[model samples]
Target: MLAILYVSHGSRVAEGVRQANHFLKQCMDQINVPIQQICYLELVRPDIQEGISRCIKHGADCVIVQPILLLSAGHDKRDIPDEIEKARAVYPNVRFIYGRPFGVDDSIIDILVERIHEKHSGSVQNDSILIVGRGSSDLETPRAFSRICAMLAKRGISPVSVCYMAAAKPLLKEGLELAVEQGPGKVYIVPYLLFSGILMRTIRKSIETSVNRFSFVLCKPLGYHPSLIHLLRKRIRESIDYDRLSAQS
Candidate 1:
């Protein structure tokens, strides 16, 4: 009667979509729900409508829609809720509970520290870290991102800075320039991205032209991790519990 639908902002790149699917599949064993499904917001198969339909077909009475995103941006806010409204028109009786994304958790910063260590493990004190964010118009996006950056900074990773891919101040070029100005050390460019896509490629292309190739290390995006799977499991549990409490009250 309960279903967990994991929603990701899909990509034009097949490998990006594949990576999202593979990551959710990894969650199957760890999470216990009657019916679990994966869907995308755009540029991929099994869009949100179809995902909801499938849950109904499988006899789910209460569906927990979980956004598999790093931040609580437009997709998690306006877009997905809009789609859920359509489903509501069709399934007035079925309960739908929307859940949160990872959203600037401390554990996420730990993964980021590990990512930085993948390349610049030697002397974080000297390393200047640049975090590349997928920007959002929602004011909360940058605020939350800044908090993540601040958390990373408190780790004593000197001069940890950030920039947006679009729709915000200090774009990638500026971020790289600032990091370069930090002076005389390896700058690890950390993409606060979950999967590989046009954004990742864009970051790579910018690095190739804008900076000395040898002086900077392009660290891997925060992709599939066992820890993330556990986090999603927590999200599902908390969502369901809150809904139950709300109904009782």
Candidate 2:
């Protein structure tokens, strides 16, 4: 039997962990697979090895490990894969397949649009968008972030800019300054994050401080939206197909 193991970058905040669990439950309902489990990368219970062990215990012959991350950063490239390698050594007989992380997808753009609509009542063209991401040291993630900004601009969201919370150039403060300089009627701060955590709190604090200087609205983090659920399901199905094709060849 094929089992699905959804892994997220866990948070220390209780609400963040709760949000992840809640999102996983929603995903479990939509996914067709019967054997599914969720675990965290760090700062939470039932880490990667334990998640895999549970799947094995449940008689899953092959396990599909899906990363619930927004970008292909260190976690996607090193940490998660290293954990899976360790698990493979422990359970030599169980087959493991890794899925790709979310990378500049249209559905993500849709989520950002939805967030904008939910938070702001004014016209989009008149407002500037400042998209914030949990910055990465990897060059690819920042490139992907730039792509997202370009995509938004193509969709007629004028004067859109992207910045990072950490590990990259043009941090959130700088991005906000650029947005303010645009002289738009209002500036919307969009967080390109999966769940609420310390980053979200920090973004909120930054916005609060800047509100006196310019019109700023902080949209909620990209939580368990239906679009995200669909994207994750698609990744899992694609991974399963790839695994089966590899096995046959």
Candidate 3:
């Protein structure tokens, strides 16, 4: 039997964990797979190792580990793979396949646009958008973020800018400053994050501190959206199909 393991970058905030669990539960209901489990990369229980063990106990001969991440960063590339390797050592017979993260897709762009529209009901043509991402040291992640920003711009949201919370250049403050300089009627801070956490809180606090200088509106993190649920379902299906094809070949 094939067991799907969904892994998320766990957050310390209680609401973050709640949101993750809630979202995963929604995915579980939509997925036809009977054997599935949820795990966290850090700051939560049922780590990767435990998740793998649970799969084994549940009679999962083939395990598909899917990272519910926005980009292919260290956690998706190294940390989760390393944990899976350790699981492999323990269960040599069980087949394991890793899946890719959500890397610059139309659904993500749609979600961002939806978020922007929800926050700012006024004319976007006159507003400057500041997209905030959970920064990564990986070059590809920033590039993907830039692509999303560009895509947003193509949709008529003028002067769209990208920023990172950490690990990359053009941090949140810098992006906000640039947005302010554009002198838009309003600046929208759209967090390109999956869940709420310290970073989201920090964004709010930072904007509050600079509220005197410019008008800013902070959109909620992209959490538990239907588009995201659809994206996760697609990833899980692709992983299962790829593994089946490999076996047939």
- Top-lDDT structure, candidate number: 1
Candidate 2 lDDT over 124-184, as tens digits, reads 8677888898888998977897788888777777678888999997998888887888875
- In model 2, the worst 10-residue window by lDDT is 205-214
User: Which has the better TM-score: candidate 1, or candidate 2?
Assistant: 1
Clashing pairs in 3: none
Clashing pairs in 1: none
Q: Where is model 1 more than 4 Å wrong at Cα?
A: none
* Residues 1-249 of candidate 3: C-alpha lDDT, one tens digit per residue: 889998978888989889889989999999998799999999898998999889889999999999988888899888999998998899999999998887788998888888888988777777788889888899888788778878887887767888889989788888888788887478888898888788888898889888534589888777678888889899888998999899999
Q: Over the full model, what C-alpha lDDT does candidate 2 score relative to the true structure?
A: 0.86
lDDT of each: 0.87, 0.86, 0.86
Off by over 4 Å in 2: 211-213
- What is the per-residue lDDT of model 1 for residues 60-101, given as tens digits with 9 covering 90 to 100? 989999999998878888899999999999999999999999
Model 3 accuracy (lDDT, Cα): 0.86
